[model samples]
Target: MYYQCVKLRQIIIAVYLSISLDGVADSSGPYLASGIKIGEVDQTSAIVWVRLTHEKRAHFDKLPILTKGLKRNEKDAESMPEGVARGMAGEVRVGYVATNEKRAFAWTDWTQVLAENDFTHQFKLADLKSGASYSCIVQVREVGSDKLSSTTNGSFKTAPKKTQPVPIRFIVTTCQSVRSIDSGAQGHVAYKTMLELDPHFFVHTGDILYYDKAPLCKNIKQARAKWNLIFAYEHNMNFHRQVSSYFMKDDHDTLKNDCWPGQTYGDLTFDQGLKIFREQVPMGKKTYRTIRWGKHVQIWLTEHRDFRTSNRVEDGPEKTILGMEQKAWLMRTMKQSDATHKFLIVPGPIVGPDKRGKNDNHSNKGFSNEGQQLRNFLAKQKNTYVICGDRHWQYCSKDPQTGVLEMGCGPVNDQHMFGGAPKADKTYHRFFGKKGGFLAVTVVDGKAKAEWMSADVKGNTGKPEIRYTELLGSR
Candidate 1:
């Protein structure tokens, strides 16, 4: 039976052997290696990204911008993933909105990367000025010395100008890998349901991208070909969502398995790994950022991988998951937030007391002191929400020290049973079977209430299960 299945899959993918364009079956158009996507929406700007077909030496008039070490005689295989965007090599432009003032640093125009390196780019709205909605788009140029280009655009509604407290809303989802959705996890269904609820925006908990488990393909090119197939699944699932979505990456999608900062490239794998990842994912830099919705909410995006010292096999100063600066940034953000509601988003479940602090079933207790410290700090804030993802399950809780509510989303694309709940507060409750669903958040009169809706296990795609609801903060 297994062999039969394998044979069937091969037959199903025979045509994939042919390089495709934009992940379609058409023979025309340039082949694409992967596709990055837009991340969270802010009142000011949003993020955008893409991937290329080849990665090594693109013949844009035969000029290579990143051919730092490759010999001229090397074949296309010698180039990295980003270098593979065009024919043998290529690059990409990550488009984003940034004003000369407020939070962004550059002007609005075409940004390009040379084929010699990786065709990857990231722009921050560090100076994205506060005002009306800002529209953003990225034009992907084929790095031929001639500059061939294609464009994809998206828009984000910036925060409204308000001096005093105001009501706010946003939805949260997680574990949304193409793998899970393909398996009929219904997470996307949950997301659509949440969107129907019409909140202010969307927040992705974590594991936005999954990498550890390779898709059903062999070789770098085939694997990347499968990864690029997500655009199709998204389109078929009608995954075209317009709400603002905040995103953070997990091990599979971001750096790599248990990846930490200062970790040197392991082998040629990482060389191609990083290049492909950069070209394919527009997660933005792994850093800390803050956004305020009126005077009632201040949300913080935490960076967990980039600058961390190391991981916890036992424990060491190198045991930083968020690094000293990010920790400090988190602390400061919490201390300074005057919003009635303050949200802290982590790449991993920040509230669970997992002993290993690894997956969802693990208790949040056995975790690091880092999260505990944040919990202790937020203990003072009556209105706080600590949300997390990567567990591949759904959970909800409230801090005993701080009546603040925290919710866990995902394995959205996967499946996992309920483990248990932390006993921090009467508000700390646990619910299950939401593995393939999303959270709908609503705010009215300065009060925020959240609902956890579980999607019907694919067989019942027409309907979903509303597991439960919880209120996190009230102004």
Candidate 2:
């Protein structure tokens, strides 16, 4: 029954569009409102995500937010009628040129964007040079016509091969809510701060958006509207346009709070949320995978919501959050990798002392069995660390049982910071703060470094103040 439901939803999404095919040709504007996303970047290849919109930017006008009892095309009954960037049918092609070289642009074949895939396309750019910066040019045209409607520009850097022992810096963050945006008029200031750092790459651990929060997204239309509204913000669009990023989804962004498989939030089913996430982002077939930045850094990104037993289930050897296959793969890859530093990127904390009421993540007692198993495995590894999201506060801790290190990046803005957990958990906490910021990690020759800094809501008028810093000697 579940599989059948999934198949039906997939078909519906494939044909869903805001405008007709004829409208695209006659329409004056088919813009790149959501900007572009570069993901799954490796030494010689990367995936570039593009979406064509009906307007130059998102509709941000005020409207009566119909949180419940949603109706399509109902001006007063729709929650975000003015916030959605209506998708249009068009043809998109991307071209690239290395930043350091004065060479002709390498262009890819034109691909059609339709409602079936939200008028978005991910173009795979292969045969790229590692450790090189590249400028991207995206051109869009009406279907069956050579006349270009729009051309957008962006840039990214590819990772160096394992043999290239180059120093690299990257940022990791999580738990961003549209409602809690530091600058409602602009976007989250964290993007600006992180952008200024000029890191080689970035990773959003999860909770990219809140589907259950106000202006509640109860249906597919509203959910997609929420996504459009977020990326429409000036800061988000500009940063993503320039930086290569890896996006992951957790409870709130995936379905709801503490969400698991086979769950539904109002009219939005679990499967619908999953489909929308993949469509909105540039993702591969699987969520859990690893990427090596250079000889010094190798990062593992995990999937938390896909294959997990219910939180209500009793704790034992069978209770799992990463499932069997992903867990085995993670262990195998970590053991085989010869990188000087290995970082495990997860949606939730593994060496945490979370609030007593929570029960979903490894930090809680509900999944202690697997949590302990992972901690034990990580104990023997050298220069390996766990980087997690979901917790609203920034923290750095070491497991008392295994001496494994873990760092939480905290929420996107200062307003979203929570004080639910104890300020001091001496047993595990090395540093803890009820503030909003991001974690910057640098992997290089003689040392592995980490810094946690805070950004203000007032457009980051002040510079990011580093609160804590850790420097580990050579491996």
Best candidate according to TM-score: 2
lDDT, candidate 2, 264-345, per-residue tens: 9889998999999998888888999999888899999999999999999999999999999999999999999998889999
Model 1, runs deviating above 4 Å: 1-36, 40-43, 51-113, 116-153, 162-167, 183-199, 216-227, 236-241, 255-257, 261-279, 283-286, 309-319, 355-366, 399-404, 413-434, 455-464
Against the unseen true structure, what C-alpha lDDT does each candidate score? 0.49, 0.81
Best by lDDT: 2
Q: Whole-model lDDT for model 2 versus the true structure?
A: 0.81
TM-score of 1: 0.66
As for candidate 2, its clashing pairs are 14-116
Q: Model 1: per-residue lDDT, tens digit, 112-230?
A: 55444333345545445553444444444444433443434444445654454555666667654433443332224455445344345567655554444323222355335434444
What lDDT, from 0 to 1, does candidate 1 have?
0.49
Provide TM-scores for the models.
0.66, 0.89
Error of 2 at 241 (Å): 1.0
Instruction: Give the 10-residue window scoring lowest on summed lDDT in candidate 2.
Output: 66-75
